[model samples]
Target chain A: MSEHTTLSDLEAAIDNTFATDAQQASVDVVEPGIVTAVETLSMQQALNRALAEVLEENPKALVLGEDVGLLGGVFRITDGLQKQFGEDRVFDTPLAESGILGMSVGLAMAGYHPIPEVQFDGFAYPAINQIVCQVGRMNYRSRGTMPMPITLRVPSFGGIRAPEHHGESLESLFAHVPGLKVVSPSSPNEAYHLLKHAATRPDPVIFMEPKSRYWQKGPVDTSADGYSPEGSRIVREGKHLTLVAWGAMVARCLQVAELAAEDGIDVEVLDLRWLKPIDAEGLAASVAKTRRAVVVHEAPLTSGLGAEVAALITERCFGTLRAPVERVTGFDVPYPSGDLEDEYVPNIDRILFGIQRVLENRRG
Target chain B: MAEISFPLPDLGEGLIEATVLEWLVAEGEQVERNHPLVEVETTKSAVELPSPQAGKVVKIYGGPGDTIKVGDPLIVFEVPDDTAGIVGTVPKEEAPRRRVRLTAALDDED
Candidate 1:
């Protein structure tokens, strides 16, 4: 053998090159759902488009939240909406989370589609009782006689380094409560369509907004069908490791996939947009091919959606997995302050660590 | 004097305090009823508060970045004597008041 083929020669060439394993994997392919030339719009703008479109389409749809009237909401998501629709239709409410949601349940019972913005993730805790007891169970309580067609737009997640309650991933809390449909949009595109879908759905939806990703630009076709909020869209596909995430974490996982490519790991990223009725079949199929799974989210690790997903994966794809399912999530402590949050959140490194752990188990 | 009390409106989602993002009306500025008078930033979104009375803005209670509580006076207005007579008696075009609850701020948690 030539000296150029020596072990040291191979080590010298490979040691300096940092390529991710995902980069080496096959390109993700799926039926391109729908595409419309969408402009670069902020999260608020996309939401406005969706709301405006829905209101125009459905006369029964009403937008309510704190300061949604002439103030147009705190984030201005409802800006100009009242002006266009009139104050009688789009109005503000007394500041009470439970009241906002409870009134919405009442209005929905009266055949109006009440869309209330909880304003912030942590702020929604007070309304948990209304959501769990009333909004969640209203349908079953009515025995199909009434439909609680209400949508709660909750702006959540971290990365802005905001205060404690400002950046919380509380999806698991709502997901655990039956009868509540949870849908989190990872980009502007999803924000527009999913909101439209959620507005029309016959059940109440906990629409989680990744507050930090409110400005991230993506294609939002107000005219296209790809942005269905009711269905989960597979963002990427691979046959080695499945990275299932939602909201802002989906973008984080995509970044992790780029880093993972250098390590020769093929990761399939699934955007679990609708978390309540999770796209279990889609997730199961991906895990089956990869034989490994890593569920990632920003919520605290204890009883987080990751745990639920891991359980679901184990239950559905246990035979296909060569390694036990893994999870990458935040610590169990309260969402740390902005400065300490970086240490608490699950980043690309954490995701890679989870993938490595799962892959290592398979190797052994 | 039209005691234009800009009570702190509910900032929504239990947001008690909001940063005064901007002042749409300055002191002594003539504002029409229902015109925007101030901008406040809460955790949820930024909202432009409408003026409750159409008159000269007498004073602003809070400056930018100050967090005001719900029901706290936000601004005052100098109304014409005719309008002054009906200040608290009649609910003359009462602007919506957002409800604010006493809750521990995020930092207050141990």
Candidate 2:
């Protein structure tokens, strides 16, 4: 030890720790069957099964995060994975979001597909540096020669009634990043397929799983079915007005549509699955048919994802639109704790009112 | 020998009942603590209930698709007389933030 450490002194100490020459091992990753059977699964089970299938199909794919391996994740989305995949493939890292993502960047560069979990949406703040600086830019920095095939899973949105830092709606932040592709699945079937597809992409994908909808059951036709993971889809069709939403809000919009039907309002529910690389064509077509639009989300109003959806609709369907696009979203404030969540999140009544705003608006 | 009944627990806040999806362990079989006993689908999520303690399965009260109330007996086990004590549902005021630990945050199965 020295009173003042010099650069050369530090370099010499690091050099003494290990050999200078690097020994790189070749990785042979094999792709197995994705999925084939049609069955019912809760969103939690579907996400878990999707990760299992991803590991089974791709030998190079690795799952790592805080409590992800040994604890199967706080949400149990990766339950039983450590036992099935062995420690080398599915392992836990310390409670460090930045380190987890930094490790993913290094692993991805070394020819391995890393699927890292951030544990919670609020926890992702620490990893912003690695995500923005390395994961999203490495491929471009290397001129497409080095592609970062990383799918970072984040359990997002509120409704779990957990304490502070447990629930967050972070799609807008991730979507704002230039090089990241964002996708949120509303159902078990979409979760299964989207996760499988997202893992195979060459670019980085921010896979946001709606925490609240993780247990909602739905039929998943595992054998290559209708919906593609790249764009949005009209889950429920109507001709009067369109309700655009993603994640947990999609289900809420569906409920609103059901209630609006009693009042002769034919509301169409469109699940905007992919937040980044926004589906311009799909949004245009859906709103064009209905001639009116209302965007719903759990995120706050100022700079929320709903604003983007409304802007996209306005840009794409301005000529055909009968009324201004409405946004029904959480109030502009920090997301509150469990007791106040019901008031913060957009409920059936809030969405219905947004629908009314659009439906009642006239050219005058 | 002593017989003890384990009631279906309320998996989530305000959940009153759940539909039995399956019984992982059958009656007349030996089981250990933490062994998954049954799967039930509540309004919130589908979760497996683990054995409260090591014992012989004496009886199971509910079948698949059967609705079991939160405090109703779901299973029964026979244990050595000396080891038996109060088994289920600590009053709300006395309960800790967490009591069950076999989950995958569903508690540590350790």
The sequence of per-residue lDDT tens digits that candidate 2 reaches over residues A1-364 is 5789899776655443221123122335465545577899988789988899888878889999987876567667787899899999999999899999999999988888899999888999999999988887775565445667889999888887777776688889988876788999999999999999888777789999988777678999888656677789999999888999999888877777777776767789999999998898999999988888888888888898888898989998898887899988888888898889878998776666666666667321
lDDT of 2 by residue, B1-110 (tens): 55666888889999999999999998899999999999999999999988888999989987899999998888888865334432111112111122111111111110
Please report, as a residue range, the 10-residue window in candidate 1 chain A with the lowest summed lDDT.
A16-25
The lDDT of each candidate is 0.75, 0.80
Q: Residue by residue across A152-267, what tens digits does model 1's lDDT show?
A: 99888877666657778889888888677789988888888788877777778899988766655676666664334555677887767889999888888887776666556667
In candidate 1, what are the lDDT values of residues B19-102, reduced to their tens digit? 798888889899998999889988889998887768888788788888888778788777643344221121122232222221
Residue A81 of model 1: what lDDT?
87
- For TM-score, the strongest prediction is 2
Which of the CAPRI classes, incorrect, acceptable, medium or high, describes model 2?
incorrect
Residue A255 CA displacement from its true place in model 1, Å: 0.7
The alpha-carbon deviation from the true structure for residue A270 of candidate 2, after best TM-score superposition, in angstroms, is 0.5
